[model samples]
Target: MSVLLEFTIRSDQFKLGHVLSGSGDMRFELERIVPTGGHTMPFVWVSTERDPNEDLPRFEANMRESDSVQELLALDRVDDGGLYRIEWEGQPEGLIKGLAEAEATVLEAFGDRNWTFRVRFMDHERLTNFHNYLTDHDISVHIIRTYTFTEEGARRRDFGLTNEQREALVLALQRGYFDTPSEVTLDELAEELGITKQAISDRIRRGNEKMLRPLLLSSAAR
Candidate 1:
């Protein structure tokens, strides 16, 4: 059985986060990570509430001058954001190395001020190793939650969520979107994530349905 772990780390705690600390109001979503010999290349989607035309240049310049960034490439540019491939210097330490050592798969990761990572390990032992590795390296992390992946009958019990859905749901919960009178609005969440209001709305709605279906069905059967 695989275990999923969700945790949070401050921007100042990780090398990649330190390099991007001057990214202004830009929000980053890590699309994928590729390990190459001692180095790691991460494809990230960069977005901002401001105009990308003005922000992108500053972003590119910062990365080029950062000691941590070995190489940078702009893969795609959209209206609001762009995709970038960044190769980091050999990381003998930090979050990337720890994940690699524990054989964890990063399911979703994004942040502006701080980062939240949802990752999976083969089992509880691997998850424990990951925690131990981080502690050994002096990397402090706040674990948000953990759950085991299991199957029942012909159904998949992993909540049946897409990455986008999971992100939306997590952010909503964190921001108190479901609070009485709502502490946050959909538009605000959209702006913070550099996404459109409609997109966020659909994600929350669909995500709710997927999660509720299983629980509601199980209750009725009982």
Candidate 2:
């Protein structure tokens, strides 16, 4: 199952760029960062202030030159927060959100600058015990948004899915009714859908098989 993860990162407190960008006020947190299979994704990283003209040139140069910085993106400042989206490789480091030390440091630094980041990937869950580990520390975290991660499909919706199928798929995906690395139970979803759990399970199984059909066939073709 393809899932979309979007993350909002706050700027580090020690950096001059953070304070200048206005990211210094409200701390940003990682919401989600899923995979994109390297299809040229959209990403955003903002500092503390709005007018970054004075410092953007140097920062952009450094970002482009930095070895650890993969494909980065810039976005326009929108209401509420900075908005930017990036297509990234096999899962950006979503695991870091679960780290107590890292989380603490990021929250502390957010007030110093404007830090905005968003990543798009495929697999939504594979952090091992990372999410739970972070929650164990008594952090107030929540999933702020949901995405289908189907730029291609949406662009060609006429041929992809029937309206009913699309709606079912979106709702199921959002509710985590589909199978995941973590053992997902269909009982609740089935109950809500007014169907038997076994029927729900069958639909999920079929849907997943359909999603992976091309890859499975390609392997056999080879």
Candidate 1: lDDT of 140?
Answer: 90
Runs of candidate 1 exceeding 4 Å displacement: 151-222
lDDT of 1 by residue, 1-222 (tens): 898888999988887777777888887877777877877788887876566789999999999988888899999986667889998766745897788778788867888779989888998999999999888889998998888765332334657576888999999999999999899999999998888875687678758977887789978999
lDDT of 2 by residue, 1-222 (tens): 444333333343212233234422322323233334523232333432233454454455555554434555656543223434443333333333343213221211122343332233334452224346545744333343445547534633332232433544565788765556533456776677775554454445434544565557758999
Per-prediction TM-score to the true structure, in the order listed = 0.70, 0.29
What ranges in model 2 sit over 4 Å off?
1-32, 38-42, 77-82, 85-91, 94-128, 131-222
What value does the lDDT take at residue 125 in candidate 2? 53
lDDT of each: 0.82, 0.41
